[model samples]
Target chain A: MDRKGILLVVSGFSGAGKGTLMKELVSRYDNYALSISATTRSPREGEVDGREYFFRTKEEFEQMIADEALIEHACYVGNYYGTPRAYVEEQLALGRDVILEIEIQGALQIKKRFPDTLLLFVSTPDAETLKNRLIGRGTESLDVVEKRLSRASEEAEGIENYDYFIINDDLDTCVTQVHQIIQGEHSRVSRNLELINTIKKDISKFQKG
Target chain B: MDRKGILLVVSGFSGAGKGTLMKELVSRYDNYALSISATTRSPREGEVDGREYFFRTKEEFEQMIADEALIEHACYVGNYYGTPRAYVEEQLALGRDVILEIEIQGALQIKKRFPDTLLLFVSTPDAETLKNRLIGRGTESLDVVEKRLSRASEEAEGIENYDYFIINDDLDTCVTQVHQIIQGEHSRVSRNLELINTIKKDISKFQKG
Candidate 1:
């Protein structure tokens, strides 16, 4: 059966290690494409337009919104950031699961618009471990670490809305779990409607004989 | 965080090879327990209680129904068959996923009673392939094969109601896919409420400090 790829929306706390997990997952797996967001913010030095982000003007970004070209968009600190629909659709058409690393609000928005999208929320095993990750790995001050912890706390409230909640304790295990989840989701009845319909029709025809 | 195992209800067309797939899955994985059904039918020679089935009298079966001891039940050819709740509950509490191989009617009943149960419907790649396997392996006459095909056609209508639709083309692939799906389901938010709630509470407490 030829199955289309899924839209995988991943969100997590700051210290959940989702970034590393995603990097390893994409690097090891051949069937995933990382989504590139379109933004109105100016690109920093050494940042490529298509690589880091698809940079656009405020007018262009709003135009995309009007044209329904963006899957989900948000205005943060006066700049617009959104996921472009074309790239995701292209990757999915080629049978590659498109991975979108977004926040809870964007994740929910995409899921609402595209019901087939799989929303995953990642978190550390406990808060103490998360705190240590934030403090131990950073050169930032205590205030910054506390701010990140507060953001994580806010994010924790929305974990219930996600389809899957992953505990990312080990990098290799988390990667395998996430990959297998995506693989398993491909077999969902809703996702494999074409294949199922064909088999249903064939069986119905055979019954008449 | 510790979590309870899920109730996995599997159904399929007659020639889908689900029985072989499940046997290999349980043999390869140690965390699964195949569920034993209770029946009012007289035990055939060599069939022991609690092994092939939990044999019971007509009165005992009706009493179990009144007591709500059976998860799902149906009468076929004047004999009653049902799944016992106590054994399933015990296995789940022990963190072992219980596999219940049943028909579409019983599968839907269990899903209705316990919404957390995962319902999977298996089929062959196509009707012709299923017919070939049925005729190739069985000693039954063409009339019986035709009856099985007819039944399969009726069962196909209920495939859309299942959470997943598996194509049983290769035995090893089917077993691995089923195992991964069950493994991935353990990460679902609905199944891991205790773990999620603890994480939420711990993060909230951390934010306060």
Candidate 2:
């Protein structure tokens, strides 16, 4: 059976290794497609349109919003960022599990819009590990690290709303767990109604015979 | 973290290979424990108490029912059969995923009692395959096979209520899929509340510091 793909909305706190986990998963598995966002912000150096982001003008982005062509959209720092509905649909039609890495608000919006969307919140084993990982990056001041932790704490409040809470202590294990979740979701009774109907039809033949 | 095991209720048609699937699952994995049912039926030759079943007299079984010990109980053919609550609880506390293979009615009852129970319904790919398998068994007469098939058709109506619909065309693949479903369920947010709370507490430390 050619099972349809699921929309996987992945949200995580800063320094939770969600980015690394996604990278490894895509590299290891050919069944996943990382969803690219559309933005009004100008592309940075070495960035390509549709590769990094689908760069669009402010007017075009607004048109998309009016047309409802984006699954979820948000304006940040005078630029609009949104997940393109067309690209996601195309990937899904091809049976590739589409991964959308977004914040809690956008994740919740996607879930409300598409109830079947699998919402997963990735986190470290504990707050101490999360704090240390942020500090270990050494790319920011202790003040910045503390601010990230505060933001993470705020995000933690919404983790309960997610379908799954993934502890990313081990990257390999976390990736496998995520893969398994998407795989098992395909077997959901709701998703396999067509298969069930086929079986039901086949069973009726015996009654006639 | 020592995660508490979940209650897995498996139900399927007679020729769906659920028995073979369960046997393979137990042989390949060490984390699962098949729940033993208590029954008042006389033990057949070589049937040892607590091995094949927890043999009990009608009075003893009634006493258990009065004590509110059975998760679910039903009378069939002048005998009482039930899932003992004590053994299931003991296995769960030890972090073992307890497997309960029962009929649709009993499976639904267990789900109603334990809201956290994961219910899975297994089936063949098509009704033709199911019919052929029953005939291939060669143990049952054609009349008995028709009755079993009729029962399966009736049972199919309740499958939509199950969490997953596992197609058991390939025994090995079906076993692996079942294992993955259980493993992925462990990551569900409702099941990991204690871990989430621990993280919340650890996060509070950062705020104080």
Candidate 3:
């Protein structure tokens, strides 16, 4: 049986180590593909067009949204970011599991369109760890750190709806758990009923004679 | 966070290699405990009580049912068989994943009581393989083989209700998939919600200034 890949939406608070977890997962599993998102924001130095972001103009991004080409899209701080539907579908069709690292709102939107898609919420072991990690980065001001912590609290409320919660206390363990989750989903009988029935029919034929 | 063990019920048609797969799983994972069933049937030579079967008397078995001590029970041919609830619970409390290799009806009964129990149905890759395996055993007559094959068809219908379907085409692959299923179920947020919330509270307290 040709196994179809599962679409995984990962969302978490800032400094939850989602990007690092995703990198570890992709490196460990050959069947997983990290989805590349499109953005209207300017790319930083050394960032490639397809590698960092699709790098589209505001007009192009809006046009894509108007055409319903994005599986999940959102406006963040005056910049437009969205996952392209075509690329995700193509990867899934080729039997590669697609991981979409997105924010909560975008993740929810994708879930509405693809109810079967697996949604995982990543978080640090505790709020203090998350705060420390954010402050340790030295990229944000104290006010920004406080703002992100407040946002994290709000995000925690919606976590009950997620399919899985991965505690990012240890990178290797989290990645291994995520890998098992995807493998387990693929083994779901409901997803492979067609192939099972075919095997059953073949068995029945042999028994009749 | 302390992770709880999973209750796994595996059932399949005879000659589907369920026993072999279960043996392989227990040997590979140190934390998995196989539930040894209690039975009124006489034990074969060299079979020890509490190891192969609980070796209960008819009166003892009846008393167990009266006290609701059995997780699931049924009479096969002329003998009574069941899984003792206390033993399974004890193993689970010790943080070991419990594996119960029972029949389809018993599996469903267990699920009805413990809705969170993971049900796995094992089957051969094809009918020919099943037939060959049964014949290779050299213990049944042609008529018995025919009866077993007919029963296999009925059991396959129950596959739809199972959470996972493991095809015993290759022993190593089947065992690995079963391990993945158990690991995946362990990672479910529904199962780990309590621990996650406790961690969240601790983190929040630590973040308070």
lDDT of 2 at A189: 84
lDDT per residue as tens, model 2, B50-161: 8778999999999999999999987644578889888899999999999987778788899998999999999988888899999998776798788778878778878888
| Higher-ranked by TM-score: 1 or 3 | 3
* Alpha carbon lDDT of each predicted model: 0.87, 0.85, 0.85
- Runs of candidate 3 with Cα error greater than 4 angstroms are A42-48, A202-209, B41-49, B56-60, B199-209
Candidate 3 Cα deviation (angstroms), residue B153: 1.2
The superposed Cα distance between candidate 3 and the true structure at residue B180, in angstroms, equals 1.1
DockQ of 2: 0.52
Compared with the real two-chain complex, what DockQ does model 1 have?
0.61
**Candidate 2 runs further than 4 Å off:** A39-69, A75-80, A140-146, A204-209, B38-69, B75-80, B204-209
Give the candidates in order of TM-score, highest first: 3, 2, 1
Q: Which stretches of candidate 1 lie over 4 Å from their true place?
A: A38-69, A75-80, A139-143, A206-209, B38-69, B75-80, B206-209
- Scored against the true structure, residue A156 in model 2 reaches a CA lDDT of 85
Pairs with backbone N, CA or C atoms under 3 Å apart (clashes), candidate 2 = none
Worst 10 residues of 3 chain A by lDDT: A200-209
Best by lDDT: 1
RMSD values for the candidates in order, in angstroms, are 3.6, 3.6, 2.8
Chain B, candidate 3: TM? 0.87
**Across residues A1-209, which tens digit of lDDT does each residue of candidate 2 receive?**
33788899998887898768987888898889999889998876777998768899999999999999999998644578899898899999998999988778789889998998999999898887898899998776788787778778778889889998889988888899998888888888888888888876777655523
